[model samples]
Target: MDFMDFKNKQTTVVVVGAGFAGAAIAFHLTRLGMERVFVLEREEFPGMHASGKNAAMIRQVVPNKLISDLARGGAAFLRNLPLDWPVETKFEQNGSFFLASKKDSEKIQQDGAYAKQCGTLTEWWPIERITEFIPIIEGSPASGGLWCPTDGVIDIHSLMQGYLKSAAMNGAELKFSNAVKNIVVHHGRVCAVQTESEEIPADIVINAAGAWATELGRLAGSLNVPLTPCSRHLFVTKPLDWIKSKWPIVWDITQEIYFRPESGGLLLCPCDEEVQDPNITKNDPLILNMLAEKISHFYPRLSDLPILRSWSGLRTLTPDRQFLVGWDPCVEGFFWLAGLGGHGVTVSYSVGLLAASLIVEGNKSQSTNQFSPSRFR
Candidate 1:
C-alpha cells in the first residue's frame, strides 16, 4: 500500500502490553507528537502483573553500569516530575542501604563509585556505624554498607496509572483485555496483529509484554531472546512497636535478603528466585522456609514477628543481568523493552524514554544503547 493508503488503513504503532514499560513507552510516544499509538493489555487493568506487584523501590545501586545510568535518570524523573503530570504520585524519599560481606566490600565500593559518577550520592559506612541510623539491625556477614539517600519508594500503581492517563489525554488508544495471539509479517515487515477479538493492522509492534516478552517475540517470528521470568515473594509482618515507619529499605547483597518499614510493620524478602513460565504465580509456601532461615541468620530480631501477608511476583531478566531494549535484529519491525530484572521501577522512566527515542529518532547514546536486543541475537 502507498503511504497515504497505509495511513488510512492502520495505526502507526501497536504496543503489546500495558505494564510500566509499555505504558511509559506509549506515554512518551504521545508526548513526542506521535498520534494513533495503540497499547494492548492482556489483563483487565494495567500493571496488574509485575508492574504493580513489585516491591516499589527506586534504588540506583544496580549490578551493571548501563542500568545505573538509566536508574539515575529515572529516579530523577520520579523525584521531580513536571507539574503537567496527569496525577500526583507519592514518592517516599527515604534512602536505601546495601550491605556487603567483608570479601565483597571493595566490589560494593566500586559499584557505589560508578553510581556516584551517574549522579547519585554514595556513602560507605562501616558495619559498626551502619547502626547509627538503623539501631536495631544486626548482622556480621557484611563488613560495611553503602548508603544512597536518593534511593526511595514510590506508589507504583499511581505512577503506572499516571503514565497511561497522560497517554490517553494525548489520544493514545489503550485496550485492556486485548491479548495478542498472533503477529502478521509480510514481505519482511509487520502488517497486523490478531487478538482474541479482532485483527488490527499496524505499521510497527513493540514487545513490552514483561514476563511474556519472549512468547510475544516467538509469535512474531523473532529470535528467542534470552529472558527468564523468575518468581520472588514479599512478606509483611504485623504491627510492631519497635519498628519505626521511617527506616530506610535495607538489602544484604551477600545474604540476598532485604527488609524495610511497611505500615507500622516490616516488609521482608529472602531474595528467592525460581525460574518459571509467565503466568499467574502460585504461592510457594515452602519458600518461606528459606525466609525463616535467612532471618535467623542475618536478621534475628524479627524472627518472632507474626506474618501479616505474603504475595509473589515475577521479574524477567536476561542471563547477563542487563536489560534487552531496541529493535530485534532479525524482525523487520519488532522492538523489545523487556528483561528489566529488579530495576524496573527504578529505571522505568529512562526505559520508556529510550524506547520511544529508538522508535522515533532511530538512534541512542552508547550508554543507553548497550541494552539493545541485538546483543542476544
Candidate 2:
C-alpha cells in the first residue's frame, strides 16, 4: 500500500498479543478514541500465559525508581477505577510486609524511603511491631520489616476481563488462536502482518507478545531488542485451620520466601528463578524441594506445610530488568510492550497508559525514554 492508501486506513493497529499488556493497550487506545484496534492472541483465550499465572499481589515498594513509579501509578489506578468497569474487580488492601535480616535492614529502610518519595505510603516497623500483626513470625533473623499498607491482593482474572470488556465495548476486536508468522515492511515501515490464515494489513503494529516478545521482534526485523523469558514457580498449601484470612503478604527477601493467606491456607514461593524458553511450564519437583529447604531455614514451624498444588510461568525480562514499552528504534510503526519482568501485574495500569500516550500523542516523554527498546541497542 502507498502512503495515501495507508493514510486512508483509519489508523488501524494490530496488537500482537492479548494478555494484560495487549488488552490494556487496546483498552487505553479505545479510551483515547481510537476505534480500529485489533488484538490477536495465539491461544484459544487471552491470559493463558504470564498474565494469568501470576501471584496476584501488588507490592509497590520496590528497589528501582522508575519501576517504583510505575507500580505506584498502577496501584493508584486500581484503587480508584472508574464506574464503567464491566467486572466488579476487588482490590483487597490487606497490605504487604517486606521483612529483612538486620544486615539488610538499612536497605529495606532505603527502599521504604524510595517508595515514600514515589508517593506510596511506607513504614519501617521494628521486629516487635511485625510480630504484633504476625504472631508466628520469628524474631532472631528478622530485624524488622517494611510495611506498605496500600499494597494488596487483586483479582487478576477480573482485572484482565475488565480491560478486554472495556476495549470491546469501545469497539476493539479480539482475534484468538491467530498467530503472526512475519511482519511485512514497505520502505522500512510496517505494512501488514502474515498470520497463519491470511495477511492482515495495518498502519501500526504492537509487539506485546509477552514471553515470545524477542522472537516476535526478530520476525519484525528488530534485531537489537534483547529479551529473555525466565521461569518462576508459585505453590499453594492445603487448607489450614490456624491461617488468618486477611494476613498481609509476607516477603522475607533475605530468606527468599514469601507467603500470603490463600483459600484458607497459604500461598508461598521460594523465589526460584530459572532462565528458560517460552512455553507451557510444568512444576519442577526441584523447585518444590527448594521451597521446602527455604521454609525449613526460615519458617521451621511451617516446613511440613502440605503443598496441595503448584504451577509455573514465564516472566520475560531485559538485562537491566526494566520494562520495554515504546516504539522500536529500528522498525517504523512497530511498537514494543514487553520485558515487564515480574512487574506486569503491579504496573499494568501505568504501562498501558504510557503506551497509549506515546502512541496517541506521537511524541517522546521521559517514560518513553526510560522504557524505550532503543536502550538495548
Q: What is the C-alpha RMSD of each candidate to the true structure, in Å?
A: 2.8, 2.4
Steric clash count of candidate 2: 0
lDDT for each residue of candidate 2 in 158-271, tens digit (9 for 90 to 100): 999999999999999889999998999887788899889988898889999998988888888874677888889999999999999889999998888899999999999888
lDDT of 1 by residue, 1-377 (tens): 11212223224889999999999999898888788789999999999888988889898887678888888999999988978898889999799889988877788899999988767899999888987779767754678899999888899988998999999999899999999999999876788999999998888799999999999999999979989999999999999999987889899999999999888898889999999787766789987889999888877866777899999999998999888888777777788999988988888899899888877765333235888876776
The clash count for each model shown is 0, 0
The TM-score of predicted model 2 comes to 0.95
List where candidate 2 sits over 4 angstroms from the true fold.
1-9, 366-368
